[model samples]
Target: MLMFATNDQLLKNAIDDLGKYVDLKDLGEPRYILGIQVNHDKKEQKIKREQKITLNQRKQIDDILKTFHMEDCKAVKTPMDVSQWKQSLARATESKQATNCPDVPYQSLMGHLMYLVQGTRPDIAFATNYRLWW
Candidate 1:
C-alpha cells in the first residue's frame, strides 16, 4: 500500500500513527508497484533531488497485449472490427439468444481492458465502454 501527504512531517506522522495499531516497517520510497513505474531519481546529480513522481504503464500494456496474443497486431484508430460488430448486432436482433464466437476470448479481454481503464488507461475508456454493448 502507498500513502501520501502534503509534506514530509504529515506523512511521517500518518505512518507513525498507523504503526501504533500495527507493526510497520518503512520500506523507504517505492521504486515500482504493480505495473506502474515510480521515478523520481536523477542519475547525473547524486547530491540534491526533487520530490517528483512519474507514473507510467507502458510495460503493463505490453505485457497485457502479449498475454492476449495481440503484441504483433498493428495499431488502428478503431478499437474493434466494425463490420464484424455490426453483424453480431444484427444477429442479436434476429434471434433472442445471441451466440457469440466461442473461440473469441471476449470476457478475458474485457476484464483486462477494464483493469487498465480503472488503473492507467483512461485513453481506452471509450473503447472499452463501447465494447461492453451487445
Candidate 2:
C-alpha cells in the first residue's frame, strides 16, 4: 500500500518509519494497468477506474456454451481443460467454416474472458487465454 500526505513532515515520518520493510515501486499516475483504465481527478482528489467488459460477460460465456448445446456438459470438477488446449490452435486454424469460432464475437468474448481472468475467475485464466489466442 502507498500513503501520501499534504505535510512533508508527515510523509517523511511515515516513509522513514515503514520504508525499511516494504518494497515500494512508484509507477506514477497510472493510466492503464492489467487491462483496467484508471483516471485520477485532481480537483476532486478522487481516483476512478473502469474496465470494459460485456454487460452479460458471465452470461455470454454460459450462453456460448449453451448455444453449442453444452448445457448438459459434464460438470467437471475443474474449470480448465488440462489436456487438450495445448493443440487447439492447429484445429482452430484448419477448420474450413467459421462455425465454432468467428473473429468478431471471439474477440469480444476474449476481452470479457481476459477481464474475468484478471478479476474474479483466476481458475479460468489459462484456459481462457489459451482458447482466445488459439
Per-candidate TM-score against the hidden true structure:
0.69, 0.37
lDDT of 1 by residue, 42-128 (tens): 653345443656777778789879988888998756455778667767877788332556766778888888888887677778668
* Model 2, TM vs. native: 0.37
lDDT string for model 2 (23-116, tens) is 6665555554454444455645333333232222455557656655567777544465546554555566777334654544666566766776
Evaluated against the true structure, the overall lDDT of model 1 is 0.75
RMSD of each: 4.7, 12.0
Candidate that would win on TM-score: 1
RMSD of 2: 12.0
User: Whose lDDT is greatest here?
Assistant: 1
